[model samples]
Target chain A: MELTLHVWRQKNGQDSGKMVTYKARDVAPESSFLEMLDQVNEDLIKQNDEPIAFDHDCREGICGSCSMMINGKAHGGRKGTTTCQLHMRSFKDGEQIYIEPWRAKAFPVVKDLVVDRGAFDRIISSGGFVSVNTGGVPDANAILISKQSADTAMDAAECIGCGACVAACKNASSMLFVAAKVSQFANLPQGQPERMQRVSNMVEQMDKEGFGNCTNYFECEAACPKQISVGFIANMNRDYLKASLLHQEPVGKA
Target chain B: MSWIVRLQKSSLGSKYIMAITGAGLFVFLIGHIAGNLLLYFGQEAMNAYALSLHHLPYGLLWVARGGLLVFALAHVFIAYRLSFHNRAARPQRYQYEATLQASFASRTMPYTGTLVLLFILFHLAQFTFHLVAYNGPYTDSLGRDDVYTMVVNAFQNPVYSVLYIISMLVIGFHLSHGLSSMWQSLGLNHQKYNLLFRKLSPLAGWVLCLAAASIPLAVLVGVIK
Candidate 1:
């Protein structure tokens, strides 16, 4: 199916971008959205023009590198799906799709449809890790976490750090992302030692980095490819508030 | 401004004021609904109900009015403070944008809230002012004074009922997210009530919507006719 695309293009980080329309003919319905994009890049290269640059790696959808705002909805109107996982079949003939990068102060656009999710890395670095050695991976039964507990932890860990939560949030908050990372570590005994410092540092870092407070909109949950629940954000709030109240300033931003 | 968010994070006073004031507003909704239902009680019953409110002891009467005034002002003040902090935390708005993606109620909050504010001002002017609209204390046929009759009379016009119904709907959508959301924001939700809050939140919104809007609808259909 042939489709008209309104894609944002900017020369660099300082360049102001606008929607420049392009046309692609004879696109296959089965092609994944990224592959369809590849077809367009191939055409652009043949014309000696710069191929549109977007984030992608291990296109199987695990890396969380593929981020784009397709049409008005994040990840192109699919529930629990990533942009790489989205297929052309979701589009119709003669449809004009608006493609842009994730919009947030923290996740600024690096180029067209590509944003720097490094702020997430910084948040994780703040307090997201378990510093305790735990004696080089003790016996599996040592801590003995229940199946239910492990499953819940896994659910929180399912977050891909894609910044969809930030993009989907009306306040552009990254609480969901920060909370998931904190809970994943805090839920397990292995992360117990640094839990206090971890939460305080992470939360303080999240604010310092310019992310908005979680207003309980729960939009991030709906937009998440992994369907990560916003419940983790509540957990983060509980932990952060406790840390703040306890006057536990983290060990220098961890 | 930053101090407000910090103070809100610091202790129970700030958030409790917000929650208590919010819950007080919730109570007012129930009372408002109860009084509005009096419209279906016919002119006499409605008039008697309104009159009884004024006949209460002076201390009690003043206390109730003062409480409502405090609750309304506090709710708006906290809302404005929260909105201001939220703005300070984010970048400027772009014409075309996408978000972590939220429910419809979540997205339209500030707009719905603005409309509700305008409605509230007009509502007070129309219902509270004597010379401009509502005259002196109403009295029932049996010589008992009543104010509810004025309510029924006011709702007699189809235009008024329709406008009231629309505002109720907007209030419904607002409460859908606003009620449980206030709790979640303050960190009151936990494992047991987490799902319960999310599920019941929408139900409560619908109940408020239907209950609040039902009065206007019933009056408009002339069920009292």
Candidate 2:
């Protein structure tokens, strides 16, 4: 199959970028979207031109390293599929695809089809961890977790920290991402020691990162590769409000 | 920072304000529509009801008015503030933008909300302040302010009725997103009622606006006479 690609090209973080069109000749239907881009890059390299740059790791889709907006939909608009999991056969013969990096002030473009997602790391660092030492790994039943809670926690844990939620949100809000991280810990017994602090700190960091607020549009859920539910956002909001109102902590120097 | 200030500065805090104030204003609209529905019962019922309100013993009406004004101002204030912040979050927009699930009403909320606020001001000017179009120190035989006649006079003009209908549609559009989003913002989510919560917005929006708009259409058609 052959395809027409309109790919955003930027030399570096400081360089302004534009969509540069290219032709993909003799492409295989089974090739993943990233593999197809690799072919395009190879052709560019053979011609002594700078190849279109994009991020990818573990083409298996778990690392959350691959990020791009294909035709303006995160991860190529396929449900529960990452860009690396997207196949060329999903497109019609000679189809034109527009690819661009995630658009968010927090996730600025670093190069063609690559935006820095370090803000996500900062948000997680703020309070996404269980600081208390639970001492050695215990017996499976020692924690006394309900099946329902375990499932809920696992569901929230599926979030890959890809900024698709921010990319797809009209406000560029990272609420879904932060909510998932918070929910994953909040639903677990181990996360109880600092539940209020975790939500409060993570949310504060998220807002400080310049992400917008969720208006309950739920576009982020639809664009999510892991199909992470927006219900986690509701949980996070509930927890955050409770923390702001009821959680008492001593005023101390930083 | 103070916890109150922390809450105010947070993104979720602004949403909470929008949701709470929006819910308050929505309830007020329901009462407004229910009261106006008395128009179908003839001038006596409407005038009597209006007169009873005018004679409230301890300025309770002023309190309610004050509360509504505060709700409205905060609602509009947070909406624009969030809108500006939201716009700045994305300095560049996608060239081939396509929304997977955001409804048309949800996308145009700020615009529709602004239009509805303007409509509310115009409506208050005509009906509450008696400052536009109608000439009357109108009173019924019982010597009460003739609110029924004032409302009928205002709606009798085709242009006025048309403007009113259009404004109601815009209000309905705003409510289509706001009403249901209120629950979501308040973190009132459960799997059992999620579908109901989602459906609440459009269903209530259509029903409430249709009922409100019906009064003007009825007046214009002389049905109230």
Candidate achieving the largest DockQ: 2
Clashing residue pairs, candidate 2?
A: none
lDDT of 1: 0.76
Candidate 1 local lDDT, B82-105, one digit each (tens): 666567555645435655456788
Compose the digit string of candidate 2's lDDT tens values, residues A1-254: 99999989988888988989999999999999999999999999999999988888899989999999999899988999999999999999999999999999999889888889999999999999998666887677877989999999999999999889999998999999999999999999999989999999999999999999888889999999999999999999899889988999787889
Model 2 interface RMSD, in angstroms? Answer: 0.6
Candidate 2 regions with alpha-carbon error over 4 angstroms = A134-137, A250-254
Q: Supply candidate 1's per-residue lDDT for B223.
A: 73
Highest TM-score, which number?
A: 2
The digit string of per-residue lDDT tens for model 2 on B59-81 reads 98898889999999999998999
Global lDDT of each candidate: 0.76, 0.91
Evaluating just chain A, the predictions reach TM-scores of 0.94, 0.96
| C-alpha positional error of residue A25 in candidate 1 after TM-score superposition, expressed in Å | 4.1
